[model samples]
Target chain A: MENRFEKQEEEKQDWGAYVKPPQTSRPSQESEASAQSSGEQLQRFEPRSETSSALCDIVREHLHALVENDGAIRPEQAAAMFAHLTICRDCAREFDELNRIVSVLNSMPLSPLPHDYSGLIMLRIEREMGGLYPLMDIPPNLATSSWTGEAAQQTSQSATQLNNRSLAGILSQTALPLWSRVVMLGAFFATLLLFLTSAWGRATLDATLSTVQDWLHQIAQATAEIPLLGAITAEAFNALSQSVHLLEETYLHIGANAMRGVFLDTAIAMGVYFIYQGRQKAKRAG
Target chain B: MRTVTLVEQSDAELVRHTLCGDKSAYNTLVLRYQRQVYNLAYRMLGNAEDSGDLVQDTFIRAYGALASFRQDASFLTWLYKIASNLCIDQLRSRKTRSALSLDSEREEGREPANENRCNAPEDMAVRGAVQEVVHHAIQNLPERYRQVVVMRHLQDMSVEEIATALDLPTGTVKTHLFRAREMLRGRLRPALEMEADGK
Candidate 1:
């Protein structure tokens, strides 16, 4: 096997030429598999014509950082690279160059700031923010931390209270004009209505419902291993599936498309909801 | 002592203070991380002025979105994410505006201005802001590869941290870093030869 691999490797000129060696090398996969199954050690041959060079590529990647910092490559791959380096003068030279490159990269100086931009940053923040937040004052002294514990508590209470504002207040924070949002919302609803009322929309809704039902059933099955939780999950999934089936039945009577609109609408809605939730979470944490 | 306590407050605490309507807390956060963020930006954008501007933009954006930050996560990692995205966006915009100055930089062997003078007597030309040569080599790489290289090698960010910053799976991050270094090895061969000569 080893002799054959070496012979194949020697014959290949370009890297691309050695792709289909296994067919030529092996008598048949069934004979090989059956031979292995008969309690024989079959050497678990890889097409070494490729992997010998492939190992070169893999190990070269591993040698990107000489020491494998942060576990750059798996231990086995690293060991392989180290072994290859000792035998292959070319890989060793490449490794040396790689090591020098990394060392040089590490030796680079922390770029000096032209000046301490902290003062300029604070001043810019103050000047630009003067009119934006009438309620939230720019800290009195940008250079000093004058915010006492008591002030933090009181201000935080106000901040928490701030989260309770109406949806309009949330909408106001966004740069989108009210008119555009209204148009978008209206268009969304219209499209949703058209999907639900149309035949193609009905088909889409039915397909989507069935897919969701399958997912819920699988989840229900997974939960069944947990005893009490599984029973509850099974029941919940049954109800959900029944509801989806009922919707599908209703869609058959009326109209709807493939699952396309559902995906498009759900994706858009999920994007908007996640963005809103992220902001809310950030606000609460902040 | 009180000042030290404020200065040393955990990022989460500072974030909480900022959310509580204390602008000072946000400023404190900025002061703590500005230099670090600036360093990352400089590495990514390959220019001092833009990196400086990105530092400010990162802080301001972080400040605006402070309420959205998860306290459990490292604030610096989160800041790096913000700075990294801004840097990539700037890099993309710049890519369309003009060709990278790599060829010109190579011809000039332009060194970084105002960078600390190389103290290591062994082959300063190969090791020093002769950094500009390397930086330009880095600049010449595709943005995705450029980002991972800067984050991993230059910023000293762990692979996991880079994975998080770039929203990539760890395996993919490793591949990019490896391939990026492989691409870089050939570009940086001259420096290694220069080092060999100095030896």
Candidate 2:
């Protein structure tokens, strides 16, 4: 068997030059089962001519075959083709390269849409088309239009009573422009003072350092007894620790103030500013 | 009352009805195209939430612009053109916004390392590294190459279909695919080597 295999391998290298007939011109009706029983199959496996590179062309085409889903070459005629690739280093490398390309391509991070994606999309579509609520009309008993005159009058009386009872209800309808002005003035002063003290004045950092320094110093002293310090070195360590504390305090204070001033407070001021601007514009237009 | 089944009606018929003041018919068209729209946007954007919003915006815009669409063009093609143009606009805006964010991060001396870390792996470390390299490589590709690569490889659109969708010449589509493959092949060389070793 080994000898036969070696003979077959040698025949492939030398048979690369056969005058191959056109593939389509070959007998098409040579069914697989019939070819298996007849000696015609073995004749088909005979090596190509020793002068033609038809076998090499087939082998290169097999490179594309390796990239295909099955990765298997078919037909008894392809036996000689495989025999050539087994011995040819270039063909083997080509096969390896094709396989490598596919493997790497598969390894790419492809985030296909979520699995329940179709269902979720359908759900959203349904929601958008009509809300989850069932579309039923109000029953006649509950319908406002069906109410008796006395009942309607009582409903209106209760609504007016409810409306009259609350100071907010009256004030909301009444003109409170003077009161709003006073309130705006108050908010302006408070925002101005808060911004100056916390941001520009840096008072928050000072206050926080004064608060946390005692705790920080005690902890530093406790840690200073460790071997790395070498000596009490209190003055140097204390100064170093104080500076660290100051740095941390400044960072926290600045972050907190920015959160307040630039984010929350700025939003508030912008709202107030827009209201003020709108009022001014209305007055000018009026 | 006869029920107008969406499936029984052609898209152009639905649009005609919508133009004739049948709001439900227009909404039906939105429902029909929303999936394809969302998939296209998501594949284009690489993020799901943004893609969903884009799909909604696409439908809303399509509804608003439905009257202007000539009946000569297929409704799907018209909608696709609108969606594609919006996606291009979105990509441009996102680029500018990303640059601003990067500048802000640099100015603050705090790099946004965690941005890339969201999709980072935890246990599959080796696979994670390979995925990271490919992700960055894809991200680094020129926009045209990236778009074609995603459409061809990810969406599995045929070259002809992609050309039709993008309104590019078929040869241009093929060239883009070829270049994308070469660029990706170069970037994934190490992974290719590992795969060859059966690792």
Candidate 3:
């Protein structure tokens, strides 16, 4: 029995070498050598007793746990299983094969996700949900344009418009409290009034109100002063002058119209106030 | 910025918000699990389109049944169970279709040509082949064994977790896993030996 125990210890050492190959400079080559060695270990193993059948049953029962735990069997229990594997070639071969299969399984690379896989899944779910909820649309800038290439420019513009519309939709939703909405509107109109009526605003407005020719002359003078800006900057300056001229024309047109429509504007504001008051009264009554 | 904070919320917190009729919260749950569910489906069904369909169906089913979901149960595990059951159904239907199709034999003959175009390195190709063989072998196992194998190996669930997910005894789960591994080892040996020899 002592001799048998000594032999078991020797076989266990061999099993360790069989499981863990020597480290080498090349990882791929080391793995190949290990695989070959493991295969050879399986081939050379020999069964020493007729009790192999019972041992095989034990191996089968504990196999999953052993493999799952990465063969870190406790010393006491390892003696029996390792002894059985050392003497019984069939169980040993099966054990080696199980280890190889598991290593391969664990080493298996994950398959690449399908193109737009998440998007496709989400789209399907949205479709199944009766299209009641809008699916999260891809941002125009991020959406792949490879299919249409340059033709996507037009589609991207529409996508941008859709994004803007969605943003507006969210802002209009009843998520904001009434008090917050009122505060936001008040702040917005107050800022607009200050921009329209302030001294700095009026001075800036008058400065931008130059005639088309005068704007072009000013742009040319600015372009001459910044010679390092080159032809591109000059073209940019010319575009800016044209834009300012258009803005000035638009400002004058609006000013003329506003002067004639003061009474109408007051009437409209009173109408809106009355409508809001009536709705509040109706809501309170209900 | 708000989205970043939303994404950082725990699954339980998201689920709570979802229960409170927050649609975007449910969307967060979907985003969190979509990749994992899709990958699981792909590994089981071995096809992107079918996997995608399974993922969508899984989410929709989960959403519809969210009210019944016990808060204490793992949301990921629950989602995986749904995906696994759907994958099984998909595999069953695919098997029926393949058995009925006369061109399946021809398709099998063309498989080598398709495999050659996998566009991977030698080690990667071997790994891919190993995975394919394992997946095919798994698909051939009995339904219970297949489910246990997927949960144990692919989904990386522990024995107890698999048992809980499948509503099986832990012993049963282990037995099925052992049996599945045995079957897989048998199917994979020749290919593995060839791979070893080639290397």
- Number of the predicted model whose DockQ against the real structure is largest: 1
- Specify the poorest-scoring 10-residue window by lDDT in model 3 chain A: A133-142
Task: Give me candidate 3's TM-score against the actual structure.
Answer: 0.53
Compose the digit string of candidate 3's lDDT tens values, residues B1-199: 1113456555654564454344566787887788778878877776788887888889888876665677678999989888888887877677587645422432342222233333333444366465666666555556667677777777677888888877789878877878778777765677776676656
Per-candidate interface DockQ score: 0.18, 0.03, 0.15
Name the runs in model 3 displaced over 4 angstroms: A1-47, A52-57, A70-75, A117-286, B1-4, B94-128
Model 2 interface RMSD, one decimal: 16.2
Model 1, span A1-286: residue lDDT tens = 3322242333333323222212222222233244234222213332245656766665565565544355544444444444445444445556556656777777777776665767666667667653233122222121134445854554444443443354433443454546656656655644654454445765777746556667657766877788745787577666655666665566565534444556477668757965885686467435
Ranking the candidates on TM-score from highest down gives 3, 1, 2
Q: Which should have the higher TM-score, number 1 or number 3?
A: 3
Please write out the lDDT profile of model 2 over residues B1-199, one tens digit for every residue: 3333545556655565454334566667766767666666665666788777777667666665655667656676566566677777887787787755542453343544553444432222345466555555555456667667666655555666678768899778866765665556655665544433343
Tens-place lDDT per residue, model 2, A31-126, is 434423332433544445653255566566544433342324333334455455544444544544444544454445445544323344334545
Error of 2 at B144 (Å): 0.7
